[model samples]
Target: MPKRLIAGNWKMNGLKAAVSEAETVAKSLSEQSADCDVLICPPATLIAVFEEKLTGTAVQYGGQDCHTNESGAHTGDISAEMLADLGCAFGIVGHSERRTDHGETNDEVKAKAYALTRANVLPIICIGETQSERESGNTLKVLTEQVENSVPTDLDGTKMVVAYEPVWAIGTGLVPELSDIEEAHNHIRATLTNMGIANADEIRLLYGGSVKPGNAGEILTVSNVNGALVGGASLKAADFLGIIRA
Candidate 1:
């Protein structure tokens, strides 16, 4: 089995003062051994600061998003190369928020993933269904299409991570049943295999959406749940550490 990865996504949250929370996490992890990989994706503004503070720690830092181009005239967009230069080891693309807010398409997400791979940064591609989609029983179909179009065809399984974040659950304090999560992850694994990814099973599948210390242990233990893509709970040292210790 691959080493589980617990990642924190501090989306649009965190300021200079927030660095201390991450530092606290790093200090705690350094005091003991962690059985899984730990990653924190703060706002782009904090990436450099985090790199400086977390240099010798076990926790890795990354960007919340990146553009497809290496260098371009695009305003307000950060490129993968720039993120790599800033010491980012990973990049997240196709997050539901991005898709919903910026109207990002799967092709655009795939381009971003390819760009990340070129810069030697792993991409954590997000995919999932909304409340209505799940209610309509189109969860698997939605996942299939997202995986088929959002991921790069030539990308290696081990070089990327896939996070399943149901739109309805993110920050809503809602969670799918453990069996549902297992089914979704299994379907994603099979989709990758069917897409001809030779090492499909090596890909780490993460579960996102209101993951907290109280429920993390049960969620993390579900089959096919390699780790978590934590949200609000990740902003606090004690809360994030609780999930990690789970």
Candidate 2:
């Protein structure tokens, strides 16, 4: 069975004060039965600190992005090895924000994914379309190409996670209907299976964008959706836990 994972992405948000929220989340999950895996990706600056705060707790810390190189001259870039060293069991690659703002390409994301795999850090690869593409009926076309290029042929589903967060839906309060999410995830499953992985349904797929506590349960039950890639709600302890409960 696919693991139920609720991943909170802190994005560009988080400060000294935000550490307390993560501490609370860690405590809450630690105190409860571990039915679902709870992970949080704060900004790179908070990775080490949050890891320290999350020690001995069920809550795990992750990084929003990681560099392909294990060590290099890439200024301002964090690496998968470093994330693992800092206690991050997972990392997110190719988020829409990184694709749009960092000029990351499919091949670059793929390289990062492979690097994460080699470093023993799970990479949550993201792929989605913008409003324009959806308007033009190119959603599947875009998603297919991304999956074809972003996911490596050799990696098994256990090595990483995939998130489908339509660019427009991210941070925009606009989400695709349940059917649309199902279609995208289904297409992803087919694409992965064609690449030679069996039991691909056990691959964890997350729905990002506009995900909150209120709508989390409804979305989680969607076919093949293992959990969520939450954004805004992740910044708050209460809302983040609510989603985990959902």
Q: What's each prediction's clash count?
A: 0, 0
Q: Which lDDT tens digits does candidate 1 get at residues 18-75?
A: 9999999999999986899999999988898998999879899999899988897999
RMSD of 2: 1.1
lDDT of each: 0.94, 0.89
Give Cα distance to truth, residue 156, candidate 2, Å.
Answer: 1.4
lDDT of 2 by residue, 1-246 (tens): 656999999888888789999888888776785578888999988887887778778888888888999999999888889999998888999999899898999999999999998899999999999999999999999999999899887887777899999999988888889999999989988888887865566679889999988888899989978889999999999999999988
Span of ten consecutive residues with least summed lDDT in model 1: 151-160
Cand. 1 Cα-lDDT: 0.94
Mark the regions of model 1 whose C-alpha exceeds 4 Å error after superposition: none
